[model samples]
Target: MNSTGRRARILVTVIAGVLLAALATATVLIARRNADPAPGGGADPVAAASPGAGRPGGPGLRVLSNGLLSTVSLADPAGPRTVTEQHCDRAYTAGGTTACLTPAGALSAPRLLVLDEGLRVKRSVSLAGLPNRTRVSPDGRMAGWTLFVGGDSYAGGGFSTRTGILDTRTGEVIGSLEEFAVFRDGKRYRAADINVWGVTFAADSNRFYATVSSGGVRSLAEGDVAARTLRTLADNVECPSLSPDGTRIAFKQAVGADPGKGWRLTVYDLATGRRTESAETRSVDDQAAWLDDRTLAYGLQRGDGTNDVWTVPADGGGEPRVLVQGANSPAVLPAAR
Candidate 1:
């Protein structure tokens, strides 16, 4: 071959090698992108897109404001972002699901909304009375709510409430506790004035705890969702909130005879029937939310007619701390892990 032809062949060989190197580099880059982990762990590209996915469980506090829901980071509460424009009287979030109580209309009944991870309403049910307390089970299978009926008021005492449970998976709703069989002192008691509220479900979806008031006396009672029965555990314990570990419950106990001024925070052990008062002396009438196994969070009304979220030690020892200001009815948004 001539010298010019030999040089042309060498140039073509160099061009082919450069093309191969570029293709190999592009393949490695594509593999690395595909292996990128999601927010929790899997390769679900939509996981990070979900609201409250990357947020911390205990600190990502969402509270109700002017009937709307707002998300505020307890670590930096100065700037709050409103997640939804719709009004929610109260809400509870767990395991990528949120259950909110929204007003349906001026004269119509209220509603219970089961929201998706993106804060969109997936399912809703019409509810009666004003929305007071709402909660979702840890596993996100069941949701419960307490509403003031007839004469109950959220800001004052001397009222009755109707509590209900809903199976999110089956869309089955237990409208009232009146349908459940009640056993007082190991005997079945059927009273017309019986009222129930403040439901806290156990880790197992079959069992739950609530305050059953009959004959003007309130008592802590455990219920079986499958059997529709309740057995009185202890008396004078109202608005019970189960702990994260399912070992104890944080509730409000009347001091003596006056249920209005006597409301105080108390922790009751489920295994052994023992109640301990917390360091807080103020009247905490709201259903407490367990931030973790050791911390209990609740809403405390200020003198200006607004409420703020406060935290106290679940063991009833440490001083109270303000978790978030200008917020009420706190529900912890658990991070996807």
Candidate 2:
């Protein structure tokens, strides 16, 4: 062949290589998108309710009843056996250990009580000067809550709110947050009362996040546990629960004119800061706790105060499946010892 013929062949080869590279890229992209978990995969079933249905369970599963926060051993398929009775808004158990809320009406304060497998209170910590929201860390080593202090009744109704952390081991106050601003009506308003609730901590316990509700406005706040500085993470969010991996937070979003109406469950990606609502959830009242990195458990109430426990996927696809009926303040045991 002549020189020109040789050059033409080379060019043809280069073009073929580029085409193959493009095809390979496209194939990889398709694979990633396919592997992506369905948007709210396990979550969808929980939202769709059917008659005579109950929540799915796994080995060693246990439920802490809401009204009394009673401990029931689910391992016995016959029925849930009561291990203890302690009226708590929330309960968490890990490695045969449990922690719950004991109304500290005695001190005119609420206390978080940690218990062992034998149903004995190991420790009781006072929350007298804190805000209404409280939660214990995943490891059950630390407790976090919100506090409102030093505000006139006019600054967003003159209530002062702050976030606080307590050292469960020593019963010491580790950190507190008081700096926060409330946004409303296209204007930002400053307030002494931050009113943070729905407290959850990252797996590493390095960062903490909570919902700040004030003057009919709700926003998520994140705090650096070491530095003790609080900043708003997202606005118009409530009932925030951190993923087990600490990469995302599951929460409920309000819809329609009334805040209570059109409430939906949504998960916010912490790394990307993108939010997605469950297609299955029509209306949810409050609370979404992570069953795992991929699954979320929460409570939903109909018109009446009666509620049910349900679980959904974080990526969003499957309908919600009821875990239990007439149960509120649902808490999951930490993934195995």
RMSD of each: 17.8, 24.0
Which portions of model 1 show Cα errors greater than 4 Å? Answer: 1-50, 53-59, 77-82, 154-158
The 10-residue segment of model 2 with minimum total lDDT is 44-53
In model 2, state the lDDT of residue 88.
57
Assess each prediction's global lDDT (C-alpha) against the native. 0.78, 0.59
lDDT tens readout by residue for model 1, 1-337: 9999999999999999999999998888777544432112323322323465224453577777666677766566545455455467888887667778876453346778777677666677778887888888888889899888777553344577888888988988899977899999899999988888888888888899998887768899999999999999999898899998889989999878458566889999989998889988898888999878888889898998888888999777989988877778777775444
Error of 2 at 76 (Å): 8.3
- Per-residue lDDT tens digits for candidate 2, residues 227-266, read 6555676777876878778788888776742453666789
Error of 1 at 31 (Å): 51
